[model samples]
Target: MHKILVTGGAGFIGSNLSEELLRRNYKVRCLDNFATGHFKNIESLLANPNFELIVGDIRNIEDCQKAVDGVDYVLHEAALGSVPRSIKDPIMSNSVNVGGFLNMLVASRDAKVKRFIYAASSSTYGDSKTLPKVEDVIGKPLSPYAITKYVNELYADVFSKTYGLECIGLRYFNVFGRRQDPNGAYAAVIPLFVKQFMNHESPVINGDGEYSRDFTYVDNVIQMNILAMTTSNSDALNTVYNTAYGERTTLNQLVHSLKEILAEFDPEIGNVDIKYGSNRAGDIPHSLASIDKAKNLLGYNPEYSLRKGLEEAIKWYWENI
Candidate 1:
């Protein structure tokens, strides 16, 4: 069995990926600092013999190096996520997302890992008004968070070209599902809305509630990461793919849907109030993804739609969170 090291494996997407890896009989080592990630995410897997957990900061080269040792592949997911968080503190975002990514790249290169598959973001699409975002085309980044994620692709490309390190980036669009924290200020919109409505609190929709996103489920992300780590095509090795279900959902529509879904849990929650706030700084109007590259190249096929994904996500949030 191949050994894979998953950074930030205690977080939402990372934890799910780690569980899938373990399910497939991979020797897994999970490295995380628990900054935004919670230990509860990985608590169930602690008894697994093939899984190992290392609580450490990715910003530390020693931790990165130690985590990569003898690992056949690296799924780099550690980062300071959220555009609003970045705007509030660009330095922290840059240091962790960008600086920490470079540290992992150098460490993985030196460790001679099979491939480096890092988490890129849809935020990198920024101000590009394109209906469905393509991998080859993108506009200037809108937030410090987007800039950091963009820089990740740049660094991975440079590493592959300069040092012969194979890297593939997956630009995930609005991923939300199990293990996603809904309490924090930097929480993703879907989970935040679900939690607020469950608690009878009015969820705030930034902008006019018209800002849309290609809301992807986390399982599709897990599939793409597996494919990326295993594929050997030279053409596909260095390029990035849009890891999404190729659909868009507006915040207004999203809130209404969440309320409707949560109604099954408590009918009273069906009438959850919504408050519209002024447009946030460093915000984009629309985000839609073109998953064609991922489809043609990686054999990637997303199996969940927004409603389907939110159904499971809402159930998990109501039960665990």
Candidate 2:
């Protein structure tokens, strides 16, 4: 069985990936600083003999090296994630997302890991104005967060060429599901809206709610990472793939869906009012993804759509929150 090191393993996507790897009987090590990640996310996995946790920061090269040692694959998921937060503090975002990413790449290369699969972002597609964004076509970054993520791709490509280190970047769209944090100021829309409706508060819609996104589920992201790490196709290595469901949902549509779903749990949730606000800084109007590259090269087949994913997520939030 392959021993995989998952950076930010206590995070939403990393924890899910770690749990899945453990379920498949693979040895798993998690490296986390707990800046944004919570211990409760990976608490259940601690009891498993194959699961090991390293409480460390990716910004430190030694920590990255320690995590990469003896690991067959390195899944780098650590970063300060949020456009708003990045706008407020670009330096911190760059240090963690870019500097820390470079650290992990160097460590993984030294360790001779078979593959380095890191979480890239759709935000890299920034001002492109293209519908159903393709991997190769991108525009100038609109936010510091986008710039940092784009730098991850550039560095990964260079690492693969200069060091002959195998790397794959999963350019994820808006991913949401179980264990995703909803309390932070930078909480994702789905979880945040769900939380607001649960409290019977008016969920605010930014910019008349016309902005749309290809909201993906975390399970599909895990699938992409697994395929990227394990694929034998040489051409698939050192490339990026869109990790998304290939569908778009406007915020208005999204709010309506959430209300409908949550109403099943509490009938009065349908009556909760929705508020509108000015468009946020560093936010694009719409985002959609073309999953063709992933489908052709990685054999990617996403199992959940926005509605299906939201149903499951809402259930988890209802029971757990």
Best by TM-score: 2
Pairs with backbone N, CA or C atoms under 3 Å apart (clashes), candidate 1: none
Which parts of model 1 are misplaced by more than 4 Å? Answer: none
Give Cα distance to truth, residue 158, candidate 2, Å.
0.4
TM-score of each: 0.98, 0.99
Model 1 worst lDDT window (10 residues): 230-239
Clashing pairs in 2: none
lDDT of 2 by residue, 1-321 (tens): 789999999999999999999998999999999999999999999999999999999999999999999999999999999999999999999999999999999999999998999999999999999897999899999999999999999999999999999999999999999999889899998889999999999999989999999999999999999999889999899999999999999999999999999999999999999999999998988999999999999999999999999999999999989
Each model's RMSD to truth, in Å?
0.9, 0.6
lDDT top scorer: 2
Judge candidate 1 at residue 132 and give its lDDT: 86
lDDT by residue (1-321, candidate 1, tens digit) is 999999999998999999999999999999999998889889988999999999899899999999999999999999989889999999999999998999999999999998999999988888888788988789999999999999999999999999999999999888999998887888888888887888899999888899888899999899999999998777789889999999888999998899899998899997778999999888889989999999888889899989999998988988886
Q: After superposition, how far is residue 77 of candidate 2 from its true place, in Å?
A: 0.6
Model 1, total clashes:
0
